[model samples]
Target: MTNYELNMKYYFAPLEGITSYTYRNVHHELFPGLDAYFAPFIQPKQTHVLETREKKDIDPVNNSGITLVPQIMANTADNFLWAAQELAARGYDTVNLNLGCPRATIVTRHKGSGMLADLDTLERFLDDIYNGVANNGPKISLKTRIGKDDANCAQKLISLYNKYPLPELIIHPRTQKDMYTGTPRWDVLEDCLRISKHAICLNGNIFSPADHQELTARFPTEKYPNIKAMMLGRGLIADPVLHREITQNRPVTQSELKRYHDTLFKAWDALNYGTSTLLHRTSELWFYLGCMFKDADKYVHKIRKAKNIPTYQAAVEQLFEHCEPGGYFSAP
Candidate 1:
């Protein structure tokens, strides 16, 4: 859907490797309200397949009914156009460009948010993606950081974005160098809202229902009353049922959490990934899950130490059985 005509509710940000098709299916079935799922970035020019696990993340049949956007990571316009064509053939209405991934491994390739460093090249890439190739469908969305090192008065970049009629511009305000290290500049974001012609969506550091509520209330509802969408990452992963909690306007019951915890295991079991791989995947979640428990560090430690699924499950059961809900807090 075009940003202007969209309901503009909650669209998810793509987290590579972790948020797989299996993960998306499990999350959708268990806890709903996600308007769309932004699939992990699909790199261009790898004829065989872009990523190891990401191929499944973008498979159409695996993600039916879901408003899926496969993110494309490319430095050149050719790669952008090529990747967009590939995703269109694979049955996606739109594909997002990964101009916001801050992980060093990705940035070193001069891709992801790293592309922002060279605005001239960035502009040309956008030009080609929009007008260079003739793809059947697939509108493009941009997921971007504010700058290469800092926000850098990115209004100039905004003007460039305004030059085209993009579907949406999901801006994560921190630059590639910032990673997830600091608070996203809400003030810079406010400036973006003022100048941006495209409908905007916020992302970064929203960790709880309270954060969502406060931000919603703070935003002026007069002119842009309908503006209501945020792309969540580590925040949602820390508590997958967080969306449900906000909708219900109540605390999630311990039993409900256990059911979710169990569901994670069941879905993981459905895949052919080795026991170690399964455990490894669930362990990555604890960094987010640890935000929920009183003994978060110890809990993460125990979960990390477990080698087998049974051991991991036992530890998980113990943590939640005696768990006291942690308050709205975050990492340093």
Candidate 2:
């Protein structure tokens, strides 16, 4: 078998509300294969000020020892430029434009995937931002869905993306309306591989080592030279050592998972966000992590219903002690 670890770059996808800086730091320390971690979208307001939480999320001190690419979600060029300049000043070498977020709230605002609905506006916004950026500023990349409602929109979208000097173009290959449903538009992605001028990073539906192998087989580097990286979001969350499994072809041990769970619990607990916030945050993690254990639905439900820290900790302990690891995580 070919050792893909020697040839491919792995990026951790930016998932809002889950893959925060703390999560990134812990994952980097323990697993150690992801090339870059894309931070959740930072929606810049006209005020051109980063919120306290946003500042903390992208703070160099908070993100030390990791290659973090801060993402910006904006409809107008001014807001995008302001945020990009701020990130550049903070020493980020590249800023990712979030054009692929499929949430309805973001879409209705004509940001995210909604930008694909109006190619004219999208082109103009791109023009202004590309022209507005200073010569010495950080390079701009894009993360986009194929279209808002139709997959065919990728044709024009790719054309416009080709006009810019993007360092990388990360495509999720699903229309905004798809909203994580159905399989990703692989046919559309194949077209992008054949025609796009910039380096292309594939995202969406990469949940296992088999999936990674299938993608590599389908889009061999010799045939699709533009396909440079693979991005994992929910899959990586479900199995923290997923990158290791794919590259090293080894299963994660139960002891490693227990240690990771314990350390993560303590790290989040130390944030002192209070009992309610801590419970809510840890519960969100269990929603994904629960899938790593075989037949863990019963324990997972208990964790979710946990109202206090003691109950949550007890439920987690029961799960680790009783359930076996090595199960596949199917997206819910």
Each prediction's whole-model lDDT (CA):
0.75, 0.89
lDDT of 2: 0.89
Q: List the residue pairs that clash in candidate 2.
A: none
| 195-257 per-residue lDDT for model 2 (tens digits) | 799998999888889888888888888888888888998888888888888888887889888
Q: Extract clashing residue pairs from model 1.
A: 238-288
The C-alpha RMSD of each candidate to the native structure, in angstroms, is 3.3, 1.1
- Tens digits of lDDT, candidate 1, 140-244: 878888888778747877778998767788988888777887788778777777788887778888778877777666665455543457888787776776665
**Top TM-score: which candidate number?**
2
lDDT of 1: 0.75
